[model samples]
Target: MRKRDLEIIKHLEMFRVMSRDDIVDLHFKHLKNPIGNANTVLKRLVRDGQIEVSTMHSPYLYFPVGNHIKKNSTKIPHYLKLVQVYKDLCEIEPPTEFIIEPQYKKGLAEPDIYCVFKGTPLFIEVQNSIYSSKQMEDKIKRYELLKQSELVKPFPTIIMITNTRYAIESDQIKVIQTPSIAHLIHKANEDSNTPPPPQPIKTNGNITFKL
Candidate 1:
């Protein structure tokens, strides 16, 4: 019934599931005894039928009431990763908008996350496992098609986070392949700060000024 409790439920509804630590870190970390406080509030929610808990995983996972996802669903880990990604981005700089698994037109791109950070939109693909070259190519092609369609105006830059680097290039849309969002943002900042390469001096008989 507290404000933070309501926000936790909202987060569950949006993210589908979150580990106990994730909830505590995001909501109760300000308290002197964060874990204890979180446990108390979460237990009350579970007792009142406001949320569901899965004890199968250590540091039990919590889900919104009426959630259809099975306790053992393989997608549980994937969603948890998204929650971590969201948390990381928040630490760097909170995103103005963040959506999970944004749906696009049929046969178009299916981005894992669509977020606006620092006034720029980004479509992120969190690859927990290595994707084959062909699979990567197919994914890029879908984004190209989506760009051509122009449904999402000011098309977002596509960022692929994977441990196994895949050689992916796209002219229609900017693509950044990195292991994490922090790396991507840091690289972008570095690139922006880098000075332009020196231009070659053109000497037409009497011209000696820098071009």
Candidate 2:
């Protein structure tokens, strides 16, 4: 198999679910006809039993072959949102490392994404639904426990992506609440008096902001 094909499969396995357009943007955008090329390649993969496709959704969602996740799993949307966040960060500066739904020892914090971007370690919590005050507090407490564990040297900052703003304060670790990663990055550049990065190369299937 080709290297790109393997990479695509690995991504599907790692991310749990990805849309057709997500695959195209990440791997085929450099080509002359990205979507066309993606469709052709994806069809072959599906035929070869390398990946599974769900036609229920427009543009279709792809999963690793033999994946346990149900085609109609409710977590599919959440995973897709996480993928978009990763893509946005890649447009600015590709993260050195990005892990989806990284797990920790029992009682430790579980973040939707754990990535190293521009030399900073970050733990991202993507809140699709409004979390109760108690739930939020418990999450913060778990993070606090994680910090105390010192499992990760030079603990990472926690970023909460949600529509509703919550007053999150902690002395152990920095917690940032933002509607989206783009807004957070833009604000960071402004604070440091640095110009925002150039516009993303692929605008389709992505949420674009002026930054």
Check candidate 2 and list the clashing pairs. none
Clashing pairs in 1: none
Displacement of residue 82 (Cα, Å) in model 1 is 0.4
Each model's lDDT comes to 0.90, 0.91
The sequence of per-residue lDDT tens digits that candidate 1 reaches over residues 74-128 is 9999999899889888877889999999988998999999999889899988998
- List candidate 1 stretches off by more than 4 Å: 186-211
Enumerate clash totals for all models, in the order shown.
0, 0
Which runs of model 2 end up more than 4 angstroms from their true locations?
A: 194-211
Predictions: Cα RMSD each: 2.9, 11.0
